[model samples]
Target: MSTEISPESAFPGPRRVFQKLNEKPLRDDLIFYFAIVAVASVLFMMLPLLTGETAEIDGLHLIWFLVAGTLIVLVQGLITGAVALLAVSLVEHFFLLFVDVHREFEQTMKSTVYALSPLILFSWAVLLKIPFAGLLFLAWFCLSTFFGVRIFHEKSKDRAVFVALATGVVLAFYLHRAVGI
Candidate 1:
């Protein structure tokens, strides 16, 4: 489907247009979850800051953090709100499009990802004194990827526990660098 556009797609016929849209083969259910996540992320980022964590924006460093935060929000918001409606879309874009993580774990994965990414992305933004936004995204993506894969692929609770431990290990490395933890 990624490669082969239908014959009817070349023409602007209604059927052709639908066919063309359908050709991409991304799932509708995935799109729905994506929208939900994007909205949630944007809202969370924009919401009034209630804590020193979100409330204060200090010097040039904080300014840079806010800027990167905005970009992270925008990217996440677009993907969640504009890009596609599927959980798979989130997984695809986030996981280097490595594998389709299937529908069963879609909800859990989307929830986990949308919930985690901004905070993790903003870690660099808030901790901008620490490193580039990409490093944060990289760390968060790696942790999220492991967990997302754990959510969808692990066959048993024991495997799930190990997956979580592994995620913690990777996350601890980045966070130690970020927070001196």
Candidate 2:
């Protein structure tokens, strides 16, 4: 592990989780993702109830629809978040090597998870049905990654930007195509 990338120092406390994500534990990151997904699922399930939009469906059918839909979304969100985390970490690791930056694989993974925290907000934006929200979230995600890469490759801002953009764009495209955002 790099001396500068110690988890303890990188993430000293969680009061400012978004700012100090690099130091947070991987399990904590996963938990955060899961918590966000659960919250979004609840919001989605409650939308019809809150808005009284179930006029088209019968009572039993409406109940089933909301329950099943929430489960499907919850499962999909967890799967998507996990895959994206692993993929981003792997992509950043290889890209760093290509740029001759010798960062530990675990360190890169930690940074990648931290960089992806904005994705939680992205989910909320999606739940709110905001206009062009995916694009907005993508921009935030990319900016998060830019700073993350810069952190990992301290002396090479240009290389960091290159790696961050390359991998971030690929991930964004993947999400767009798979999630149909």
For model 1, residues 24-138, the per-residue Cα lDDT tens digits are: 3335534554555665665556554533346456789877877787679868776644432243334343432333334444444443444354553354354435445645554
Flag regions of model 2 displaced more than 4 Å. 1-19, 44-55, 124-132, 152-155, 175-181
lDDT against the true structure, each candidate: 0.48, 0.69
Q: Which residue pairs show backbone clashes in model 1? A: 30-85, 30-86, 30-87, 31-85, 31-86, 32-85
In angstroms, how far off is 2's CA in candidate 1?
51
lDDT of 2 by residue, 1-181 (tens): 5557877667664334434665666678667766765675566556767767655777789778877888887787678667777888888787788888766676677667666766664565665666777777777666766777676445366887788788777877777843335
lDDT of candidate 1 vs native? Answer: 0.48
- What is the clash count of model 2? 1
Residue 78's lDDT within candidate 1 is 66
**Measured by C-alpha RMSD in angstroms, how accurate is candidate 1?**
15.1
Q: Show the colliding residue pairs in model 2.
A: 11-23
Q: So what's the TM-score on candidate 2?
A: 0.67
